[model samples]
Target: MPDRVRPMRTVPRLGTYNGFGRTLLGRTKPDADGACFATHWFTLLLLPIRPLGRYYVKEGATVERSTGPGASTSTTEYVFLGEAELRASEVIRTYLFRWVVVPLVVAGPVTVFGLNSDAYSREHPLLFLLLLLGIPIGGIIVLAVALGLREKFLSSARVPEWVGSGPPRG
Candidate 1:
């Protein structure tokens, strides 16, 4: 039998995140072989030791369209591992709280104490540099802890029903 040419469908745009990012949802119609595919795209933040950047992660799923003629369709669901479904705002808040606020909370007191002691400041000039470096280190630690908690929460929780709903089509 000749291969069937499936028409390409337009994916739905779920949410707008500042002009820098967007979320895409899509599902391909079943082919001659009775196989269907679903896909999703979302922006992700990549924090490095120095410069930070953002990128998109594409996730997808595939399954047999149906067991037999007029039979119920079965799908193989895909879930993001070690990550929770978070809104753009939550993601931003998470990074800020973990990478900025937590570090400042720790660094503020140490900075104050160091500046108050003349002897310490004079004898330990390197401490200032160390404090500067500690901010990033503290932020890294906070990121790790936050990710761990998110993983735990996601693992124990159920995937939202909306996530399984293939992208809206016009």
Candidate 2:
């Protein structure tokens, strides 16, 4: 009779599978707008130096390793700095990235296109107002989005808050 051999198995570190670094850059995850943070900043600061389209770079796995019950794998994701410093300027960059860029995307082009259209048209006057209003409105929207994104993604974890706003009685 011939002898049979069993395949080797491995166990991944606890919580490692749930980590952002691993899943974010893994093959199973699709390449999406994970570049939102980097894209946001470029659209603001650097885009003015060059052009809007040249801001964000491609997103993909930079490092990969397998470690599973049999063959699990992980990857390290990276964002192109695009002339922007990630550590030294994270706070300001994060602010600009989240707020200004995202909203301007919709408002800026619309206002520009609307205002440049035939001035003789009746809608031209309305578009002029729209062009003016769009600036501040876009700014506010960007601020809100930036604040929200920061709270959601940038905020660090801490101990849970106490219930009822104070100490609990035994």
Candidate 3:
């Protein structure tokens, strides 16, 4: 009988995104040269509708100078190598990542109000009640801010449809 050999298996890379709207999800782990495949998605709100092709991307850094006096910051940035097919699991990850963030989001206010309110509620009942109204106001402002930041980040993403493309990359 002829000898039989087993085929080698490759593991699909798994990645979670921190921001939404649309995304270029990493398709494979970065190789030794720091290049990988990433697929950009077309989305409606949080739901991913279609992949825009897989593009090659390289991991790199983006530096931004502050408008103020001599301040600058560097953030990890991806150089698009050019490719989009979004899997259901990747869409699900969008939801999962937000769920994971919920507790920490809720915790901040709860902790702040819980720790500070006892005396305030008892001594200044009306003011304490009024302070509760600020929660929704703060939430609206936060939502606006989050959307704005998503725009800034996506500007460099070459996101095809959902949002507009930023800059051309390799």
Candidate 4:
């Protein structure tokens, strides 16, 4: 009887995955070579919403690996594409809209409710309190969903063919 040979297994190479960044909420993770991936999570906190919502942004390179002449020969390449910076002006604009504008717009209703609390409570105490509490909670939930959808749209729009593109450069 002839002896059977075992097939060789190939293992994927491991690289660094460290995070670093500074903002309201953001992180960076290094990839192979000199490229790194970054993600930013922007949130608004004001008005009736305790935590308004989040907007996410990502920047990084695309990596592509191709096999050479031999099965053991493989080459890895990188391509740098995507938004690299988060401008302060844009962030300030978003902040102002969420913090100042939103609160000012909501103040009218809140003031009316405050002034009529006595009559409102007398008529429907439970509902009055519920309205006050539900405002913030409902705002949070609605804003969260909206932001989540926006994030998905923005991420998809940024790079439709990001996969197998190549690694990013500085």
Whole-model lDDT values for every prediction: 0.42, 0.38, 0.50, 0.40
Candidate 2 lDDT score relative to the true structure? 0.38
Candidates arranged by TM-score, highest first: 4, 3, 1, 2
Best by TM-score: 4
List, residue by residue over 31-55, the lDDT tens digit for candidate 1: 3333333323444342212212111
- lDDT digits (tens) for residues 1-170 of candidate 4: 11111121222121221212112232222223333322233222321222212222233344545456543322233232333334354455555656675565445455667786888788998998888777656656666776676655543232122323332334
What TM-score, over all chains together, does every model reach?
A: 0.34, 0.27, 0.37, 0.39
lDDT-better candidate, 3 vs 4: 3
Model 2, span 1-170: residue lDDT tens = 11111121221121133322111110111124343222121222222221111112235665655676667665544433222112334444435544577557656666666666666345567766676667667766766786667666765322222223332223
Candidate 1 clashing pairs, residues 3+ apart or interchain = none
Per-residue CA lDDT of model 3 for 78-149, tens digit only, reads 655433334455456544544444434544675688687998899988877666666645755775686567
Candidate 2 ranges beyond 4 A from true positions: 1-86, 89-107, 120-124, 135-139, 157-170
Worst ten in a row by lDDT for model 2: 21-30
- Scored against the true structure, residue 115 in model 4 reaches a CA lDDT of 84
Local error of candidate 3 at residue 131 (angstroms): 18
TM-score of 3: 0.37
Candidate 3, run of 10 with poorest lDDT: 1-10
